[model samples]
Target: MSALQLQSAAGLLLLPALAWALGGFRRGVAPRVIATALALQLGLAAALLNIPPLRAAFALIGDGVNALATATKAGTALVFGYLGGAPLPFEEPFPGASFILFFQALPLVLVVGALSAVLYHWGVLPAIVRGMARLLRALLGLGGATGFGVAANVFVGMVEAPLMIRAWLARLTRSELFVVMTAGLATISGNTLVVYALVIAPVVPDAAGQLLTASLVSAPAAILAALLMIPPAPGEAATEGEEGIPTGLYDSSMDALVRGTQDGLGLLLGIMASLIVFVAIVALVNLALEPLTGLTLQKVMGWALWPVAWAMGVPAAEAATVGASLGVKMVVNEFVSYLDLARSGGAGLSDRSRLILTYALCGFTNLGSVGIMVGGMTAMCPERRHDIVRLGLPALVSGTIACCMTGAVVGVLTPP
Candidate 1:
């Protein structure tokens, strides 16, 4: 690798440590635990990045993204076929066949939701959460309840994840609340994975699985980072509750599948609406900015976030472009950013740059999300609005850093 690449790698590796420093790890028990976590994460990043087989696995993840896109497109086309619109001709059979993938992609959310329900019913998810909770408790000194909630965020939605520990919400300390918020920001619901994969699959081709894994991996990273930001008090543990998943009103597998399909449709509509308004707003902003500074959001991002992109180990020449992508992710939504990444049609970014972008845009930490999280969490725990408000920015910062860490780790392991 070039010197710049090496520097980028080093910067990416240090992001978690930097996040802790910025988030207030300079004093108390937090300092030691955060330091150790950073060290362990760095070591793990190095080891994983250097292994040949692991590198290949990540690359395969990229390919999986492409396959997922194809699947989503195909599903989309099937759904639209009934809408009676003329088929758009395509140069290749795959592209034409892939139309249904878009519609089918939404189903993934419901699939995950239903699967979560069943897992919860069968106690599988709880067991996994308990195991992860134990690790976080031992390593980061987080309360068991907080650790379980954080781990649960990986499989479920932000609002829903906390409900698993609903009984404890009223009693959680400030630091524990921060962990919950940060974890929510850092992880995406399993239900939305297919949709996000569909968005970026065209650009990165086969990145769906990788993006999914990135979100899952970032869950732990977010938890660790959040704990570093505000270590648990001297004698705190997450309040414990009876462990079991709620059995939704479904009698059979077919019934669950049917309900899941309907839920997926609703989610798909929400995503589409969100994307429409968000993109339109960005366009409006670009138009407004075009006259004053002769710089659009895209250009501004290129200039401002290039260093961050470089720090995450994107090639120097591509750093600005990747930075622009990161900026969009932070300022807007990951969905918008992923669409831009895929359709930018600027000179194509390097494979590594693409991979890094995939990781960076894998979270739900934009300004819009702050409202969603705060509103949703507050609604669940009406008594903790003040705590939620205070913890919001820190959660955003830690969540963003966790994503950046994932990008860096992926970049290090990615073959040049």
Candidate 2:
């Protein structure tokens, strides 16, 4: 990367620290800790990117993007009966080729949901949660319940994570609540990984794995940022209790399969609906803005986010374009942004710029998500409704910063 790109990436990497400092963590020690963590993470990302062996290691996640695309193509072909109808000379390789990808990717959500129940029943999830909580407790000095809740987010959906700690949500401190909200906004659910992969794999090399890593890396950054924003208050922390999974929910493995398939169908429908409506709204807005501003809403977003994109290490010429995608993610949704990124054909973006954008746009930071998190969490813990309302804006800011941190890391690691 150029010196300017490096500086920009550094600035973005430090943005979470800046947000934390500005939001609350003004004490001498707090600033130092935040700065040190930021530095360490940046250095780690740089080392991983520059060290040939480490990059090779990351590359070994088995090209999830290619697998996803192949599956999607196969699924599409199967559904449309295009396999045999097309002018291909040979028979369709996979009889239900199109169905295979959809089955592999979309069904993952149901499988995760059901497997999560099984894991919970078997105490597997709690064990993982406890391990993650230990790290959070030592690093951020968070309460056991809050730390576990945040850690649970790594594997589960935003709404599902809180269920593990549902017993304590009503009693959680404000700071703890904020941490939960921020974590939800910062990370993507594993169930949606295939969906997002299918959306951007055409544009992003290794889209599934890279986006998956982005979500995973953003989880810790989100927690760290939230802690800095609202340092844990001095008080007795919530304790971990018996949070076992429901064992009798499914009759057998086949039962689980049937239930999972049904659930996946609902989720797929919802995703399709949301994407259609959201994109249509953006189109309508752009139509209105075009005549007034002499440019489309997209161009305006690109212009507005250009500086931040540059700071995330996108090449200067492609900064606006990438920034526009970020703006779409924040203003609309990550799905919409991913679709646009995949279809843009690398306009105004270099290979490195595209990679950075991939990381940057890999979160649930849009306006729609704020309502979803607040509504979902509030429903799970009605007593905490007020707290959810109060922390909504900060959660949004913290989440965005967390994703930007990931982008910065990717930027520094990617060679210009």
**lDDT per residue, candidate 2, 1-416, as tens digits?**
67756765676656765776767654323555566556655665666556787667655543554454455456444654544122345566774343333334454455445554555555576687778777767665567778777777876667777876788888787777888888888888766766777666567765666766787677667876777787665654544442442236567666765675576566666666666777789889988988887887778878987777877877677778887888889877887777677667667778877888788787788777787778788898888888888888889888888888788877766667
Candidate 2 is scored at a TM of 0.82
lDDT of 1: 0.70
Q: Which ten residues in a row have the lowest lDDT in candidate 1?
A: 82-91
TM-scores of all predicted structures: 0.82, 0.82
RMSD of each: 4.0, 4.6
* lDDT string, candidate 1, 1-416, tens digits: 76655765687657766766886654445556656655555555555455678657767765654555455445555666622222555444664354343344554555555555565555576677778777767777666677778878877767777877777888888778888888888888766765677666566655656666676668667866776678666766555542433445467666665765676666667667766677788889999999988998978977887777878888778888888877777777887777667667435687777877788788887777777778888888889988888888878888888888777767766667
lDDT over C-alpha atoms for residue 233 of model 2: 57
Identify the runs in model 1 with alpha carbons over 4 angstroms from their true place: 1-5, 24-26, 29-32, 39-79, 82-112, 115-119, 202-206, 233-255, 345-348
Q: Which stretches of model 2 miss by more than 4 angstroms?
A: 21-36, 43-60, 63-127, 234-252
